[model samples]
Target: MLSVRSKAVASALVVFAATPVSFASAGGFGDLGLGNTDWQVGGFVFVAPKYEGAKEYEVRGAPFIAPTGLDNGTSRVQFRGPDDLRFRVLEFSGFEAGPLVGWRFDRDDNDAARLRGLGDVDGGVVAGGYVAYRGGPVTPFVSYHHQVSGDDTGGLIRFGAEARAPLASGIFVLATLGASYADDEYMDAYFSVTPGQSAASVAGLAVYDAEAGIKDVYFGLTTDVPLSDVWTLKLSGRYSRLVGDASDSPIVEDENQFFGGLGLSYRFNID
Candidate 1:
């Protein structure tokens, strides 16, 4: 049971660069509490491509990030994003630091015809930490993540900023802008094609070696419109543009990627 639940948690991490995992109960009050006053847990559905550059889209759904407030009965606070889940434990003034974990889905060659020779890049656990500063309306953050499981799954450094604004009728919006610098192992697994691979590809791919560089620049926006005290409608959209080594790869069919999702969630507050 523990192992299976662990797999679910890991699977949830692949939401954006994608571990946006969730937890629900089969019985009882139906919400898991993380020792915060405003903890929220809910589910949502989204549409996205199977792989980074692929054009085909699939409809999938998962639970949203159930955030726990970080105020330990003090003045400090915590923040969480879809890809990384960690409660800020260290804080000074407007700055905070904490560990981060995420999941990246494997690129299965069978998922697309163009990837016939590339093989599979095993999805793995991304473990790292983050540092951020809360400056009024905007929060700027930088994080380092490394794949700890699977062979040569690679790693990346992500820098981003988030801001929130409220609209009329209690509607709210969260906006994000970020970029990722992938390591050679990450670039190679997804973009590089070896001589042997080039020959094996049915797409007639050329041999290419992808080096470490900026993988992509991304922008995302999420809006929440309250339908009731316990229910909400969430609409999210994201765009990612592959750059540098990732863009020039032979296997890449599209350099501009997009995903959008609309979910109806029932938010339950922890008592």
Candidate 2:
């Protein structure tokens, strides 16, 4: 027989051990799966900069719902974040692969007061797929998405790993590290500045045509604390560094960006 605290610790370990790790990329949720076949609902408040390089920060709220379990024959539906919604179409032998679709917010000059003349990047729907393998305490995954409708017509590819380790009573820590690659169209849309555009903007701003390459590398840490049988609290922090063409873009003010958030979730099991 296990005590309440012991049970809580065991449950936390199972959840982290069974799920795929995700990094904080556009339209990405760090940890998600049908593990334990339980439904979860939660909301979070986070502080993030307006754009990759901007100095201003904005506090925003997001809601999430995971409505499927990780049973062998069960399907999964999840809303991981504002820009990440996915459905698992296939599941077998510890492997889950599915279609992912989501919306991306436009980056307007107004997003950051200092970007008034940099122009706006239109938001649109992205469609893609993700394949993940969960074995023991290590999960490795890959995902790709293309801008199906928007001003940007490129795609993105991401690969990452997630690992978990128990710390103390009912507490666990999860860490994620990943890298992202962007296509030429996507890179140019966000990082490029045309000669005409440069002339219309501040001095020393050069016309740059960004080519496709590794855009950023990111890492994140999440602390999970089980409060009760059905409730859990999570605290997370992430840092991303712009690299290659993205880092060289004159419009970019800060090459590194940070984000932090906290959330509480409730789980409901359906039998």
Which one is best on TM-score?
A: 1
What count of clashes does model 2 give?
3
Clashes of 1: 5
Write the residue-wise lDDT of candidate 1 on 128-246 in tens digits: 88888886778899988887887666888889998877676566566789999999888888889999889989888989999999999999876666778776666778899999989
* Residue ranges of candidate 1 with Cα displaced over 4 Å: 1-11, 14-42, 63-82, 268-271
Instruction: Summarize candidate 2's per-residue lDDT along 60-146 as a digit string, tens digits.
Output: 555555542222222354333233445666667888788887665567776654456778787677788888777767768777878
- Show model 2 residue runs off by greater than 4 Å: 1-42, 62-86, 91-95, 168-172, 202-204, 229-231, 265-271
Q: Compute the lDDT of residue 253 as modeled in candidate 2.
A: 80
TM-score of each: 0.81, 0.73
Top candidate by lDDT: 1
